[model samples]
Target: MKPLVWIVALAVLSYSTISGMVGHDHHVLIIAGATDGYLSPCGCVKPMSGGLRRRVTAIKQLSVPNMTTVIETGGFVKDSGRQDQMKAEAIAETMKLVKVAAINYGLEEARLGAGMAASLDRLSGEALVATGLGGGAIPVKKFKVSGPFLIGGIDPRIEQIGAALGSKLEPIDESVRALTDEAKESKLVPVLMTRGDLESAEAIAKKHPSLRLIVCSVKSSPYDAPRRVGDTLIVTPGEHAKYVVRIEWDGQAFTAYRFFDLGPEYADDKQAQEVYTAYLARVTSEDLLSMVPRSETDVFAGSAACAPCHAAEQRVWKASAHSKALATLEKEGHDRDPDCTGCHVVGLRSVNGFRSRAITPNLTDVGCESCHGPSKLHAMNPTKHKLAKVGKESCMPCHNTEHSPTFDFDAYWAKIKH
Candidate 1:
């Protein structure tokens, strides 16, 4: 009886160890809309959201030992200029620190033109191992991970400009093929892909029946929520771009915990919308005004003008960094240099001795008109004339490093003391 008891105890201990090693369900963290290097209208000098620093911190907090995969769902370019390239480099540096697994190109990459896109791609490939539904260690076919997973890099959609520039786009199917082949040999499993190019993603799943795929795109519709399409778990982050899909892959099955970016609503308050609106108004007005002109033409007039009618917004802007960025440039002597003036002084042109007075009164500094196109008609009749907002591509002309090395998102935003 004693001998039999010992044998049973040993068997149970061995089983427990093995289960802890292999069958101990996996925890996968999926991050979407990682626009690290991209520029946004909220402020050109400093990005309001999706910067690399914040992302690194977020990833570190979420990382676990089992098997962690961090997937960056593209949209990383802000401008085509050298500064944008440097920003991409900065993003790459951040990725290295965070130990990201893969990255997918977003529409912004396409707008950067093929040359810039190729350059960024090369940089990322060199810096981090490309892993996705089709390119990394865990291939889409029969891939599995024990726990803690992070996958990166899977961009299929070419930006409109990149398409027009005749970039040889990578088909989704080919990318998936590469991903699956690599995964078969790697210890990691469970692949991730960005939004767009849904057709190719769908086709890949159809061809490979064993792989699990997670799709993330900006324009994702709620209708595609948590559905199984040919062995792929097509989960969309929905309207709230900031969300984490926590998945636990037990030995026999996979379960997921979806954390959506609903702001502070989890506290049971209906003020989420109001808080968001107010925060946006503050960030835009303060941060934006600081970088561009506020009263005189250039970048400041339009926003300033709009503020009178938008008194609430104007109050918010008064407390933001946009209203302070110009002063920082002045203190740094950036306003004196011709190269720096373009970005610092709003309407400061690249032409020799570009004077603010030479341009229209409204164009004296960085204002709404500088980005949103001419607002003269729209101002006259809030509805008759259409007001066109500036596209993401419009910011590159002055934001790139060709102007100055100090032109970074975090550093610039930090300068806004208010």
Candidate 2:
């Protein structure tokens, strides 16, 4: 009688384990957004994060076999220009290669106009989805998982800037309702992607309680943990591709969440490297650096003239990293990138500013004139050209929250005090 009871207990336990395995279908939802056309970090700065190459390595590692779905909130580039178009193509290829389930259209994509957006959507294998301001994008995209997952996107700014963009704005509430209704009828879990920070997403959640998840782009840090409002889970994937957010689902509610920082830990993907190399080649071929708009400004005298007047300041500048700013970009093979050159060199946005090492050798690095407001006239005639007193604001052009996150004015000032 004891052996019989033991056998029954063992059989019951085995059945329970098998049933649980069959019933639960765990999935990981990976979110990335606000790339703003950053393919890789400029190695000029230390502890810099983000890049498509690093993101690929992260995705490959975090992905589970047939259980991962990647998506982006939006904002592909900073503006709609020739170079921006090229960036969009490169980003589309990268995301498509990673098998992204859906990508929401942000203000930057909308600025590209409907036709250009459509071309990019096809280039990305039709992964782009937009609501309210629709052209070629689908309102809601369905991904077949355990119970089928439906995703949609909306941008509030599309309506506000429609006049300037020449775009037709649709009703946001209607679009949300359509997505909610479709998911309800199909018995699928609905998710809405938005680029309008937390408050806007919370408003949407309040209006449409059917949305189980809202992946949003925030103005704050990307590493902010996921928050719950009623039944909806709002997740921020960070900005400029600095961080990737992951959420775990067990065919019901979110089980876990984590933020993957794209730092030095991950290896750069070979394919992504090829893409970046191709982008740089295009920028060089088009001579986009020369094409960058320039305003006629006070001439820069270069650091040599400053040496005669202020030898002590010159020594400090040379000893500091500012003297070798261009060298940092050169080491990373980004010497010709216009986006980076502006910060590394002196007066890149001026007519007499740094063009190339050959053309503007004196202005190759962050010269004294970069912060002193181009002291060419001052060097020529000190009496007439009085130098404007520079303060903490002088460093802000290059040392803002994005490029230099850990910058402390007084601490940095101490190093180069003149």
Candidate 3:
């Protein structure tokens, strides 16, 4: 009887190993939405979630494979002091560190105007490639990876649509058809990360049955219902703003698993205030001045001038949320308003030439003093006088209800690459 039992156990083990009968045996991890510099303050709540450090830790722990492919849907661009170039630089650095597979450019990528966007693509390291479905495709050196995985990027618009009647309709059919053809020829699944609506995506998927997954970014919709059209899977990140979806292919079929924690929603009262207060203390006026080198007496040199002397600090500031604030405001059209211009501009009303009205200096753009308060006192002393240092309280003035939907420091910080 003991010999018979042993034989049966051996047979069972053999079957499990050969057949791959375990349901969850193939493990794959997919992480998305590290918007980084694009974050804003949610009501009174300070940023509590998302940053590169935490993200790196999370990825390190999950390094074991069945397989893992991390994809960012979009929104990697944000106005960082001079331009949106810093956002791309920061993203490239982070991707290099985290080893992300591919990224689709969001609508914000176009915010740096057309020329700057091209420059950003050039700056990102060779490991990452930027591809699009239509004429906007930028060629990158091919990267070799093992397994039956295919990563492709698609730009949302086919033709540039200016404000005009009947301009609403553009020819995206050809682009989708081309992408589908490419996928079928390569025997690889096609994933789309775009700013288009679900309805538009469903329409496109209808024509291209080979496109398996359509991951929508830029829109916040409910997640309970993941629309399936033909053989494609349509999903949006929803309220759990950032999410991870794991796709496993076993030489036969593909299965997906999604994991996300949106953190907490912004509350109007005390908790929000406390979080804001804490975040502000982290960066103050004195802190900003300290970041500038004492050797550089020209305080008006802007962010680029400070970069050479304080390489490490400049790297950190380049990745910070404050740097991108002006660009975000401008993109959102808040730059036109006086109320918003003050905070978004370096020195709005001060004699230190920090105001947006200083066109000759080109200080209208977001700069160091935007978060550090006025630099007048710090400039006067250079070394002796200390301006107000930023603290959690300092961040609240801008990060509160006036700016973002919800702010999680940890989540926001996790997205920053530098």
Candidate 4:
């Protein structure tokens, strides 16, 4: 009886010790990634999700004071150019304001070259992390809130832009091995940030089980829950700044995880709005609207030109929102912005397109020729130069999923039917 009693007491003691070891040092992790040049909602669509302003608000609201740590998974902009460089810089500034701990140097960042990359790192408060690549990016970033938490970033397509990167690229597997080994040696929890799909991230996770968390850009819908590959947790911040993932860690493992959509509920942060306003001011000051590469079009005979023969059609269009497109931008103070003007006005993408309300007053707004095709010649000849038939495909250029998520051809056409 005494031996059995001792065995039971020892089992209870071991259980209590194990429970004590799993400490409850609560910490919050706020992650944003795969922004892809969407600094803010295009404003063409109402109640839109995504924007740097809303992101700041979301992070501020969700953050847990000193316990919270912010990080970005890169893919900040979709393309490379002067505008993209400006966007990257603006993103870096916003990240610095949030005190983001680390940011992954993804393919887009690499394309910007070492000079721009280094500049961005400085703008981001020196939070850039790159494991396999170079250029003002640290191989690993260490955080010491609960303890030492090490994070490393890898761009899987390193070889694709190796020359542009201006540094010898290490293999992805080698980079992961180094990060994991260092974490093990230093007794720190390891996190990896990667740009690509979840499958590739999971493959890396399976190879390096020591990686505790992998924040990846899934490039699609945000995952509702973290997917587990072995003992490691794989998560995503979603694409295009539409969502951010929050993870609550209790030292040993994640206690709570959620993907918060940056919807209308998250109001725009004032500082972030200031950053965005400054960006717009740059766009306007630089006259980027004129710099846009224009395609050569035969003619754009404005909406009024059609009113002579097709008075009813012109009336339908005037009654619809298309005619008032420029007004919307005017109200928002984005009337001069190239990004918005291209969609709001006619011929902005053509040499003969709308230049300004002063230069081409006739071309302002979504004109008759916008959907029906440029028709100065057609208006003159009438019978010989017939107008091409317009269809639902005509609207798709601006009415894409990102701009008009609720667009229905039937419903919309009904409203503007001639």
Model 2 lDDT per residue over 1-418, tens place: 6743543454345324422343347777788878888878866456577889888877776666577788888788988898898888888878877788888876787677667766777877777777665542333232322325788888878665465456565677887887788789988888888877788888989999988899888655554467878888898888788778877777788756767677766678888788878888888788788888999998999888889888999999999999999998888767777878899999899998989989888998989988888888999999998999889999999998778888999999998898
Pairs of residues clashing in candidate 2: none
Least well predicted 10-residue stretch by lDDT in candidate 1 = 262-271
Clashing pairs in 4: 347-353
What ranges in model 3 sit over 4 Å off? 1-29, 34-36, 39-47, 78-83, 111-137, 140-146, 161-171, 238-241, 250-253, 262-399, 402-418
Who wins the TM-score comparison?
4
lDDT of 3 by residue, 1-418 (tens): 6743543454344324432432443434354553645332221234343343334444443344445566665566444333235445555545545466665553455444445445644544333333432233332312213245555454465343212111232245654565566667777656655457788778778877787777665345335445789878777643222333444544545554333333232122332233323323332322332232223222354555555545886677767765776676656444534335556656555544443333524454556655555444455555785655664565466556536446565665465433
TM-scores for all candidates: the values are 0.48, 0.83, 0.52, 0.89
Off by more than 4 A, model 4: 1-24, 134-147
Better of 1 and 2 by TM-score: 2
**Tens digits of per-residue lDDT for model 1, 1-418:** 6743543454345334432443335555545444434321122333122233334444554456545555555555545544445445545545545455555555555455545545554545432222322232221211223243324345554345335455343455655565566566564454656555455556656776545756655443233246577667655544223333434455334554343332211222222223333433443334332333333332224455675565775565457544454555555433333324455443443222124433433344444444455454566667787665544455456556533335665564454321
Clashes of each: 58, 0, 37, 1
Q: Model 3, 178: alpha-carbon shift in Å?
A: 2.5
lDDT for model 4, please.
0.80
In Å, residue 179's CA in model 2 sits off its true spot by 1.1
